[model samples]
Target chain A: MTRDSTPGSLRVLVAKVGLDGHDRGVKVVARLLRDAGIEVIYTGLFQTPETVAAAAVDEDVDVVGLSMLSGAHMTLAPLVVKAIRDRGSDIPVVLGGIVPSQDVEELAAGGIAAVLGPGAPADQVVEVVRKVAASRS
Target chain B: MIPRHNGGVNSPRQQWQKAFDESRLREGPFQTLSGIPLEPVYGPDDGEYPGQYPYARGPYASMYRSKLWTMRMFAGFGTAIDTNRRFKEIIKAGGDGLSTAFDMPTLLGLDSDDPMALGEVGRCGVAIDTLADMRDLFADIDLGRITTSMTINSPAAVMLAMFVAQAETAGVPRANLGGTLQNDILKEYQAQKEFVFPPRQSMRLVRDTVAFTAAEMPRWHSISISGYHIREAGSTAAEELAFTLANGFAYVELARQAGLPVDSFAPRLSFFFNAHIDFFEEIAKYRAARRIWARWLKDRYGATSERSMQLRFHTQTAGVSLTAQQPEVNIVRTAIEALAGVLGGTQSLHTNSMDEALALPTEKAARIALRTQQVIAYETNVAHVADPLGGSHFVEALTDEMERRAEEIFAKIDEMGRGSILEGCITGIEENWFQGRIADSAYELEQNFNRGERIVVGVNRFLEGNDDDDLAILKITNEDEAKQKQRLSKVRSDRNDAAVRDALDRLAKDAVDSEVNLMPALIDASLAYVTVGEMMNTMAGVFGRHVEVPTI
Candidate 1:
C-alpha cells in the first residue's frame, strides 16, 4: 500500500486486461466499489498487463482487480502479477468473472488475493476488496 | 356422454356465468410471478392474421406446422480440426444448422501467432488464420447442403471469403452455398467491442460483403443484424429491439447509398435476437421487431417485395442469464427461454449449455442443451400453433407497448443523425450514447439483484444445498495454440510469398477506392493463402485502426 493512502480511504483499480470485451460485469463492479465510498480507477477494455500494472503504480492504488471472462485467467492473471512485481509493487491483485472452480486454488496460490465468481453479491465483492486492501496496509 | 343443452331454456351467457360461479379454482393469486395480472379467459382483440403486412402475428402462415425451427447449436473451440469433429457430431445428432464461434483473436483480425493473441487463442472459440484452416473447419461437411452461420465480425470479410474459397475448392459453386454471415459492425462499437478499422471504413467492408452476396450467392444471408450482444451487454428488452432494428435500418440505408436495390438485398438481411428471461417480454419484443421492420421497409425504404418486408430472425437463449451456482438449473432456464423463442415465431433457435457461466460446455452438457430445443420441438404442443399467444390481451398489449417504446428510441436515434438512421448510428457510436445507455441498464439490474428486488435462483435466494463443485467443465489446453501456430507457419512457408504479397496489395488498392467492391480481391487473397492478419493489416494500412474511447 502507498504511504499516503489512509486506512478508511482506500483506492482500487479495476481493469479488463486482454482481448475480452465482456465489460458488463467489470463495469458494474466498478460502480459497486465506487458507491461503497472507495475511489475506483477503471482502466477500460483491451488493456495489456504492463499498462495495467503501470497505471496501478502511477495511481498508487491499494488494490487491483482484473476481470477475465475469456477463459484466459490461468495464463493472463500470472502475467499481470509478474508485471506488477517487475514494477516493484506488491499491490494485492483480485480476479473476477467466470473463473472455474479448479483454477481458483491455482490463482490464489499464484498471488491473486481473491477470485470472485459470477454469483458474487455486491457486498461480498466490496468486503473482499476491503479485506485485501486492509491486509496490505 | 350424449347430454345436450336446452336450446331455449337458458341463454349461453347465463349458463357460462352459472358454471363460473360453481366451479372451484386453484388457490388464490392466479397471476404471473412477475405480478402481471391474468384473466381466466381472453377474447381476440385485433383480427390480424399471419403472413400479412406488418406481421405482428407471425411471419409465415403455417409457422411450425409447415417447418419446425432449425435447431442450430453454436460450437467452436481449440483448433479448426477440433471444431470440425464437433460439427460432424452435431450433424449426426440431427442438428439442422451450424453456427460457428470464432476465437477472440480471429474476431479481432489477429492471427494465432500475434503477441496480442497470446493465451487467448482457441480459448473461447476456434482459431482460423487462412484458407487451409477454413478447409479443416468444414472437413467432411457438405457446404452446399447444410447452412452455416459464422458468428464473426470485423474480419468477417476474410472469414466469408475463406468460406467461399473453401467451397470452391470442394467443387461446390459459390451460388450453391447456403449460410449467414454475422457481419454486423455497428453493434461492435456499441456492445461487443471486437472492432478493427474505423466505423466508416468498417461499413465499407460490410457494404462490399452485402453487394458480393446479393450478386453471387442467391441463398446466402448477407448480414444477421444482431441484438443478442446488445441485450447481453445489459440493455433492456425494448432497447435491444430498438437498437437492433435501428442498426438493421442503418445497413439498409448503407446498401441503398451504394446503389443496391432495396428488394435485391433486403430479403436476405436477417436478424439475430437474444431470448432472455421474462418470457412474455421476450415474445412481445420479437413480435414488435417484426412489425417495426415490416412497416419501415415498406413505408420508409419503399420496398415492393413482401420478402423484403418480412422480418425473419434466429434466437439464442441468453448466455448472460446463466448462473454459475446450481449450474444444473440452467437447463430449466434454457428450456423456458427456448420455449419463449418458439412462441415468438423464431425461424431458428440455440439453447445455451448449463456450464457456460463457468466454461465452455462439455460434450454431455452440449447434448443436453440440444435436447432442450428438441424437447420444445417434439414434446411440447407449443409448436402446434403459430404465435399461439397472439390473441391474449396481456401479450397483445405488451407487444404494443414494446413497439411504442422502440419507436421512441428510433426517433431519438433519428434526431441524432438529423433524420438519417445511418448517420445517426455513426454519430451515436462516436458519442458513446448507446454504450452509456446499456451500461446504465446493466448497473441498474445489478443493483436490483444486489438489493434482492430480483431473485436469481441459487444466487441471491435459495442459497442452501447448492454445490457446483461436482459439475464438470470443459478445458482448452494450451497445446491447441502451439498446433495452430505450427499450422500457420507451415501455410506461410508453403504458399508462394510473391502471390500472397500481390493479392494483399490488390486488396489494399481496392480498399482505397470506395467504388470498388473488395470481395473479389479478398477472395483472391484467401486463395493465395494470405492470412486474416496479413489481409487486415494491409487494409488497416489504408483505412487505419479504430481505437475506441472507453465509456466507463
Candidate 2:
C-alpha cells in the first residue's frame, strides 16, 4: 500500500515451514523488517506449498523468506520453491533459523536464494534482502 | 479523586501517575518488569481479595491451601521403552503426573523408518510412530489412575487416538482416562512449527478432538491453549497472556462454528502458559488470564457454565532463558520461575533441570528439579497463603497495566480480522515487532551481563575454570530405534496385504472428499496397522504438502 522508495525497499514474508512449530524467530524478523520500512505479511505457520505460492503470487511479493528451524528444511524448502516455479513465477526464497553450516550449500542449491544462520542480526537480514530484491528488479 | 488518563498520546503520563499516586522507576528502561509504576508505599486497597477482579490476587478462593498444583516433571527422551522406564522413575521420585514431549519425527507425524525421519527419531522427546509405540510409551503406567499430558500440536488428534487406544489396550475404559493434550495449534503456527496439515485442515483435527472428546473423553482437556512457547520465544508476560487468550478465543469460536455446544466443550479447554524470570509480571499475567478468559467465555461466547469460564493452565519455566554458562545458576532461575508459576496459580507445573541448556537432563538434574517443586510444596510456607502478593500496590498496578497492554495487541489482531487464527493475518501481529523487541532486548542486555556490568552471581562474576571437568552428560544407551524398526517392519510384513491396501485406499478417499472428519478412516487404518508416515503421506498426497513462503 505504501512505499518508502529508499535505495533498499525490502518486503519480507516470514513463515514457518514443515512440522517444526517454532515461529518466534520468524516473528522477530517480521517486526524488525516493518520497523525498517518494509512490507511484511507472515503466512503464519503450517503453510502448504500451494498456499505459500498463492500468497506470493497474490501479494506480488519480491522476496519469500521461509523460517524452518526444524531439520525438515532440506525436504520442505525445495517443495515450496517447486510450487513457486510450477506456477511460472520466479521469486527468490530465502531461509533463516537453526541451519547447520553444512546444510547451507544444499539449501542454496535447492533454489534457496540465501540461508541466514541463527545469530544473524536484524540489520544484516535487511541488507541481504535489500540486495536480493534490488537484483530482482 | 483525580481523573485517570489512559496510556495514550492524548493524556500525559504524569497526570495518569498523579491520579494513581504510583511512584518511581526500578530496573532499566524506566519501568518495572511488569511495566507498572512502582510506588514506595504499602496500603490496604492495593489488591482485591482472592478471586476478585483483575485476578491479581489469584483465582481459587483457598488457592494452594486445599490442594497443591500437580507436579508434572516433563521428561522423556529416546524411544518409547526408554522413556517408559524413565516415567516410572519420575513417578517414584514423587512426581504427580506425566507430561510427554515427543521427538522431532513423532512431532512431525512420521514413523521412525520414514526416510524423512533419519537421524532425528528420538532426539528431543519420546518417539511414538504408531499405536504400538504409544502402547510401549505407557507400558505399565495405569492410564486410568494417573493423568498424562502430551506436548503435541499438529498431529495431536492422531496421537490422542493412539493414547485412547493404548488405554483401551491397558483395559482402562476410554471414559475413565484423564489427561491433557497440548492441542494448541495457533501456537504451533505462531511460535512452534511442528505441524502436519495446513491451517484449515489442522483446525479440522482440532475440531475433531473438541467435538469427539466432549462426547467421549469428558475428563480429557482437548486443547491446552499455549502461551508457554510464546514467552519462551522472548515475549513479555503481557503479550504471552494476551496472544494466548486470543488464540483460546479463536479455538472457542472454531468449536462453536463446528456445532459443538460452547459450554459443553469449553469447560474442558485448558491453557498452558510460561512462568518466566520476571516474578511479579508472571504472577500478574496468570491473574489477568483467568479474569479475561472468564469474562470472555461469559460475555462473548455465551458460555453459561462456570467450568467453561475457569482458565485452568499448566506452566513450565522458560526453557530458552536457561543459560549454558555456569549452568548451575539455572537452578535458582528455575526455582524463581517455579515459584512464579505457583504464585500465578498453575494447575500443573514443570520445572526445568539445570543441565537443560547443555542437553537432555541427567538423572541427578531431573531429580533436583522435582525436589525443587517438592521443597516449595512442603518446606516453604508460601503454599499456605492464598495470593501472597494480593495487597501490594505495585502488583495491583501492574495487573492493570499488563491487562491494558495485552488488550492493545488483541485490538490489533482484531483490526486484521479473526476466525481460523489461520487468516494469514495473525502472523502479521506476531511480526508487528510486538513480541520481537523482547528478544532484541534480552540479547542486547546479555552483553552487559557478559561485561560484568549486570551481575549474575555464578556466571559472569564468579570464576571457575574447572567447571567442565568430567561433567557427565546423560547419554541415551540402547538400540531402541533399531528394535523399533524391526518390530514395525515385521508388523507391516505380517499384516494381511490386501486389507492394508484397502484401508489405505479408503483413507485416501476419505481425505480427498471435502468436509470429511477422516478420523474414522484414520483410526481404521491404525487398526489395520498403517505406519504413521504412510498415513500422513497419504493425506499429504491429497492435501498436498505445506510449502514455505520466504520471509524477505
The best candidate in terms of DockQ = 1
TM-score of chain A of 2: 0.90
Q: Write the per-residue lDDT of candidate 2 for residues B110-203, one digit (tens) a residue.
A: 8878755654557668887777778888988998888999988877877787787678777898899899999887765555546567666777
TM-scores of the candidates in the order shown = 0.93, 0.74
Reported per model, the fraction of native interface contacts reproduced equals 0.74, 0.14
Candidate 2 structure quality by residue, lDDT tens digits, A41-66: 77865567677888887777888888
What is candidate 1's lDDT per residue for B326-427, written digit by digit as tens?
899999999999999999999999999999999999999999999998888776556655677877889999999999999999999999999999999999
Over 4 Å off in model 1, which ranges? A1-8, B1-46
Relative to the true structure, how large is the alpha-carbon lDDT of every model? Answer: 0.90, 0.72
Please list the residue runs of candidate 2 whose C-alpha ends up more than 4 Å from where it truly belongs after superposition.
A1-137, B1-48, B51-56, B418-470, B477-480, B513-515
Which has the greatest lDDT?
Answer: 1
